[model samples]
Structure formats: C-alpha cells, structure tokens
Target chain A: MALCNYYRKRKLMDNLVGWWIRLMVFLVVALPLFITASLLSKSWLILGHISLPELLFSSVWRPLAGEFGFWPFIISSLWVTFIGLSLTAPVCLLSAIFLTYYGSRRLLGFMQPIIDILAGIPSVIYGVWGILVIVPAVGKYLAPMLGYESPGFSIMAGGIVLSVMLIPFVLNILIEIFRTVQHDLLDASLSLGASKWQTIKHVVLRKSFAGMISAFGLGLSRAFGETIAVLMVVGNVVGVPENLFQPGYPLPALIANNYGEMLSIPMFDSALMFAALLLMVVVVVFNMISRRTIIYLESRQ
Target chain B: MAMETTKLSIQNLNLWFGKQKILNNINIDIPENKVTVILGPSGCGKTTLMKTMNRLVDLQGGARTSGKIILDGEDILNTRRDIALVRQKMGLLSQRPTPLPMSIFNNVAYGLRLKGIRGRKKLTPLVEKHLIEANLWDEVRDRLHDPASRLSIGQQQRLCLARGLAVDPEIILADEPTSALDPISASVIENQFFKLKENYTILLVTHIMRQARRIADKVVFMYLGEVIEQADVHEFFNNPKQKMTRDYLQGAFY
Candidate 1:
C-alpha cells in the first residue's frame, strides 16, 4: 500500500510538472502578443467612438480644438514609400543582376560582407548621417530644381536617403534569389542557343520573380514605416507640398513628434495609436502580397 | 529528311583543366545518321568529351581544349557562327533533365522561339510534330497546357526528347537520358531511339552496358578519356577486341 501511494504521488508530480511547462510555454509565446492584442483592441474601440469629419478633412492636429486629420501624413508616408521603392528597387535589382551574371565571383566575395554591414547599421545611424550629409547637400541646389522657392527639410531628401538605406536590403534579397536558380536550368537555356543575357532574362529572372517581388514588398514596408531617417531629412509641415523640396511630415513622424506632447489630450494619444494600427495594416497587406506571390510560385512548379 | 547530310569528326582532340589533362590524344569519328554509343566508366571524361562536341565545354574559363572538331568538313573552332550552328544542329540532354518551369508546349517551343519561329499557327504544328516523333503526343495531347513538371519522371524524360527534337537538329546527344528512369521507362526511351535513328544521328552515353548493347549501332568504348576500341555493335559486344572492353562488358572495369 505504501509503495502504491508513492507511485501515485510520483504520477501526480509528473502531471503538475507538465502543466507548469505548458504555462511557461504559453507565457513565452503568448505574452507580448497578448499585450499587443490588448493595445489593438483599445485602438479599435477608440476608432469606433471617434467623431466623424475630424478624422477625414481636418489638417490642424490641435487636440483641444478636436481637429485631427491624418491624410497629409498618410499621403506623405505613401508618397515617400512610393518614391523610395521606385528609386531603390531598380538600382538594387540592377546591381544584384550585375553581381550575379556579370560580376566575378571574386567581386561578389568582396562585396557581400560590405552589403551585410550596411544592412546591420541602425535606422538612427542612417538618420544622423542623412541630416549631416544629405540635407545640406540637397538643400544647396535641389530647392531650385524642385521649383520651390526655398528647400528646408524635404520629401525628396528623405526619399533619396531612404532609398540609399534600402539599397543593401534589396540587393541582398535579390542576390539570394538569383543564387537559388538551378545551374542545370541555366545551362539548359544557354545550351539551347540563348545568349548569356537572354538566359538571365528568361530563366533566372523569370524563375526568381516571386522571390524578387517578395523582397521588394518587404523593402517597401521598411521604407514606408521608416521613422527616424525621414524625420531627420523631411522638413515637417502639414500641407501637400507640390515641390519635391517642400517640407512634409509622414505618419510616423507625426506620432513620434506629437505623442510625447499629447499628455493632456486623450483623443490625441488614441489618434496616434490609430496611426500605429494603420501602419500595421500596411505591413500586413505587403506580407499578404508576398504570400500570394509565394503561393503562385509553388503552384507554378 | 529533305536537305543536307551532316557529320562530326574529332581529330587529335585533347582537353585540359588547369594543367590537368582530362582527355589526351583523342581522335574519333561519330558517323552521320547512326546511333553511336560511348561506353566508359565514371570520370573517364565521357561527359567532358560529350560536352566538347557542341562547344559547351568552351564556356568554362580555365578548362582548355586543343583539338579540331570538324563538323561536315568545316573546322568549328575557327568560327563563332560555326560553333553556334553546331550547337543549333545538335540537341543535348544531360544525365538529369533541366526542364524550364513552364507548360509542356513552352518547354518544346523554347528552342523554336530562339530560332526566331513565332506566330502560333507556325509554332503549334511544329510542337505537335516533334512531340509525336518523340512518342509523347498521345500522353500529353489533352494536357499540353499543364506544367511540364507535373508529368511523371518517365513522361518528363520523353518531354525532354520532344524538346530536343523541336529544334529539328540532325544530331541528338543524350548523356545517360534513361539513367534516372525505371526499367519500363528506360525501355520506352530506348525503343524511341530505334525510331529516331531514321532521322537523327545519335551519340548516346551511358554507364549501362546492356543499354548500349540494345541500341548502339556503332560502339566507341572509351576508358579514361581514351578510346579502347571501336567496332560494330555486334562485334564490340560479342567479340570485343580490347581486354579493357571485354572487362568493361563483363562489369569488371575498375
């Protein structure tokens, strides 16, 4: 009977241990997301309760007056992302194609480490560098070229700086895609009388289109959500600036610049949270687009 | 069938990879409108020799060759257009296929497109004719629009054969085409070779002695990048002259 009791106790202890492990696993995987979910739900509630027209047309973000329209910031953010992807994807893709097809293996061995180092550098470092170098350089003559009277902090500067930062990421992703193309497939195309460039265009690029699309999609998200660099380079003003050199404030910039000062205004703080929610949506949509591309690639095979 | 007679002759051929002589003093003739099987052990420079025939080996930077590969009495090494023409006239399928990620029709049409044959009306009939000649039309006729990769391994091998034939090459070089297929599929491909012999000159490379015996009209038995013996297929199999060829035929090659 005493032996039976001991076995029973041991089994009970094992069950307790298993429950403890489950709890630990749940905490590790589920906690941060729990907090994020809570925050998201609260933002949705705030969005549901917010007064109408103030969310749309109003540009003045004076919390006391209850005028809050995020359109200008949204436009600026989208405009910057568009400009950045356009400039970055082409240059980076071309470089990657060059590196894969034209560049020697020796040159690739030399350039890869530099690209990695550039990838690891923080956004703040890019921002500080942009402020010190790009702002002054572009401001000198770009103001006239953009047809603006005077360039202060400019969208064009931010877009260009952001483009520079995005280059390495795009190049690395493209290189990885290019490298994954099968050598046999490449040989097959070339031996069939296609030229070297023709093989790259038809076989390598066509095969890697899904991966390339995903890489650019990820890069666009990064460029869109970029905060510190754009803040440093863009002249923060709340109107649609036709001139590229004109001052603009993206959504993240507004949240970053105003969240600390939004102490007294309850709706204002929630409005910033709403902007966070919108940014999350942007990231989610890009990821979905990338996922679709991946699915298409798998189906193609 | 309607036009020209072409032939391949290699004289005093030698190949080197960065001072390591892979093929030495190689000289041979592969006849036009015949099934020539090259029999050799692994690393005997059989693949290297096969690649050298169509100038595929020329793309390698440090791998050098000194030889005269005369196609139809013209030295191919002396001219770029000649090399291109040689490659265009010859279709090569490697030991393993390298099918493009495409529909069955596109994979066949790939070479045709490169040859500047456009317009659906022109391309469609050519694709069907080649597929029919390759013995793949019956299986794929209804599903020609499907991805080529969806086919079974046996079907893929035949599809590759169709792809090779689409370019209308007089010579077809298959480096172990059926090595990856099952016995049934291998036999199927081997049977297709007999039918193909009426049109295309075939240079087949395989480690399988049985396969070479079954299909080869002329056997060029090579060991270590050197031709041990050349004879009619019956003589090479039933009465091999070289001791090495006899050993290789009996699976005693080391």
Candidate 2:
C-alpha cells in the first residue's frame, strides 16, 4: 500500500510538471499573436478612415489639421538604419577579425570589460553623449568641412550615434561567428602555405558567410527600432530628408513623442498605434526573411 | 641499402608547452626521396616533432622551443626567410582530412592561386594532374564543382592530398594520414605513399608497427619524447639497440 501510494504521488507530480511546461510553451507562442491582434484592432480605426497606401506615401503629417501621413517617418527610419549599418558593418567585422586572429590574451582580457560596458550603457546616456560631443562637432567642424551651413541636429548625427551604439552588439556576434570556424581548418590552410590573412579570407569568412548575414540582419532590425538616441539628434522634423545632412523624424520617435498627448486628438492615438504596429511588422518580416535565407544557405552547404 | 642524401637534419631540438617538456633533445636525419617513419606510442611527441619542422607549433600558445631544423641547407628554425616559404617547401597531411569550404576544383586551385596562377585554362590541367596523382581523378572528375564537404571521408582525404600536392612541396609530412580511414582506404593511401616517395621525401608518423614495417625505408623509434633507436627498417625491427624498442617490437606495451 505504501509503495502504491508513492508511485501514485510520483505520477501526479509528473503530470503537474508536464502541464506547467506545456502552458509555458503555449504562452510563448500566443503572446506575440495577442500583441499583434490588439495592435491591429487599435490601428484599424485610422486604417478604416484612410487607405494604407495614401497614409504611407503622403508626407504631410499635420496632427492639428487631422492628417497622419507616415512617408517622412518611414524614409527617415530607412536612411538612419542604412547609414548606421554601413558604418557599423565594416568597422565591427574588422575589429572582430583583429581580436580573434591577432589579439593577445592580455589585450583580449582588457577589451572584454570595455565591450561589456559599452553594450550595457543606456540609449539615453548615448543621446546625452551625442548632444554634448557629436552635435557640436557636426555643426562647427563637419558642416564647414563639407561646405554646408546648418544646425548640428540632422540625419548624419543620428547615424553616427546609432553606429557607435551598435558597434559592440554586432561585433560580439561576429567574433563568435569567426571563432566557430574549426581550428583544424585553419591549420590545414596554414600548412598549405596560405598566410594568416589568406586563411581568414578564404576559410573563416567563407565558412561564416551565413552567420555574417544574419548578424547584419539583426543589427538592421535593432537600428530600425532605436528610439531615444536617434530622436534626440535627428531634429524631429516632419519631412523627408533631402540629403544625409538634413533633419528627419523616424517612426519610433513619432510614436514615443506623441503617445501621451494623443488622447485629446480624434485619430491621433490610433495613428500613433499604427506607427507602433508598422514598426513591429517591419522587424518581424525582416527577421523572417533573414531566418529563411540562413536556413537556405545552410541546407545548400 | 645504399645511403641516400640527407634532406633534413634536426639537431638538439627541445620543446615545451608551458612547464611541461614535450620533445626532449631530439635529433634525426631525414633522407631524400625515402619514407622515413617516426614510430612511437601515443604522447611520444612524434606529431609535435613534425609540427616543429614546419613551425606550425608556433601557433600553440605558451609553446617554447630551442631547435635547429635544417631543410635543404637552410636552417628553418632560425632562418630569416618567410614562414610561408618554409611551409610551402613542406606539405603536411593531418590525421583527419579537412577540405576547404569550397568546390572540389577550388580546393586544389586554392594553392595554385596562392602561387599566382590564374585563369581556368592554366588551373584546370594542374588541378586535374594533382587529383590524378592523389588517385581521386576517376571518382571526382565528374563533379569538380561540387562542394568538397559533400565527398566521403576517404575521398575528402584524397582531396586534401591533392590540395597539398598542388603546391609542389619538396617534402610530404604525413602525420598518421591513414589512421582515420577504413582498412581498404588505408591501403590505398599507403600505396600512394610508396609511389610518391620516388620523387618526394615522406616523413610518416604512426604507432602501428605493421604499417611502419610495410612503408618505412628508415625508421626512428621514439619513447617518452626521446629518440630511442634509429636505423634501417629491417635492422630496427630485428635488432633494436634499446631494450624499450625491443620490448615495443615484441608487443610488450603500447
């Protein structure tokens, strides 16, 4: 009777644990759907008022006059992300390669804490740093150097700040990717008379091509959604940027800047919700496409 | 047997990994155009000694070495010549075949390209010739553009051999090249070594006594990071000077 009771209790405990695990898994899958559905329902108010094409393509974002065109914000988001990625990719990749291949143990040890601290810093702090350092440099030094006269707050400032913020994040992933290449493969290449640079170019880079793409893709998504730092330096102008030097407003900045005061306006809250929904959808779609590309590359290999 | 010209001579070679001494005062003369087998049990520093010859041991952190490795009248250990030049003179075959992450033809052409040979017309014949020399031409001739990773273990090993040979090295350093293969594949590699020794000096590292007897013209026996005996293969087997060598030959202990 005692043995039978022990077995029954054990079975009951196992059943309880199994149910808990299943519930956790279901929640993970359902949470995203729930958020998306709520966002869709909230944004439908404005979507019903105007078609998405007109809302996305028109740039006249007059909140008081009741027009909510998202074209300027979308373009600003793309330009900032593009400039950030362009600056970040090459610098981070080269740093990762140098650290992995030629860095001494002591040098690596020294760099580890610095990189951790960089990655741990808040975006608000970065914005402050940009305001203090990058803004003046752009306005006083860079504008004259480039033969332009304007306030420092522009898309260029946002891109430079975003690139600095993203360096450690992208670099950490790339270092791991480069390190994942087999040591024996390196040995084989070295023994074959290839120099260290040659081996890295032919073997390490080739082997980690898929990983590099995914790392860049992740960097892209992160850059696309970065809010405070970009907003602080981007001048928050509601227009399409004429050039890299022009002031522009991105989607996240718009949503964050207007969410509190949006309740009084008729469709203002719905428009802000639409902006959030758009950001979420773009990030999700980009992640899906990169994931598919990675899977395809790995299978072909 | 007639004495052959000395191709490489190692004198007073000692190596250390941190505080642990790995190769202790090693000395050996490798003859040209001959299969010189370094026969030893595991952890006897056979592979380390070979790695030192090509200076691949420099890659290991905390590794310290004092040695004089003379290759073709040049002191490889202390020479001002480029390390790449030193490595280019010797082709090393590791235990497992590690094909470069590329198509079959490209794996062979990689070395050729490094030597400044470009264009398909120049590379195709050379790649084909090396593949033929490695005895893999028939199996892979149809799929030269297929990824080298898709090849079987045996075929990949041959591809590595072809890649090594494409660089036209004077010496072939094969560290248990057949150890990862099946018996049939092992025999095929052994046959290739026998034929290859006519043109290139081969230094083979192995623990298998039967394999040493089969392929070795000159044998150097090692124990606990020291060279115990060195002689012609027959004499080394039949009349070992060291008691350890005699015991090892009789299968007393590994």
Who wins the lDDT comparison? Answer: 2
- Please state the CAPRI-style docking class of candidate 1: medium
The CA lDDT of each predicted structure is 0.83, 0.92
Give the Å error, residue B247, model 2.
3.8
TM-score of 1: 0.89
lDDT of 2 by residue, B202-230 (tens): 99999999999999999999999999999
lDDT by residue (tens digit), candidate 1, A74-163:
778888888888999889988999898787778999999999999999988998888888887778766666556656578887898899
Q: Return the top candidate by DockQ.
A: 2
State the lDDT of candidate 1 residue by residue for B46-149, as single tens digits.
99998888777866667788879888777775555745556777888877767787899999998899899998899999999989988889999999889888
- Candidate 1 residues lying further than 4 Å off, grouped into runs, are A1-32, A41-45, A51-60, A146-152, B1-6
User: What are the per-candidate TM-scores when only chain A is compared?
Assistant: 0.86, 0.97
Give the clash count for model 2.
0
lDDT of 2: 0.92
Docking class of 2: medium
Superposed by TM-score, candidate 2 places the C-alpha of residue B38 at a distance from the truth, in angstroms, of 1.9
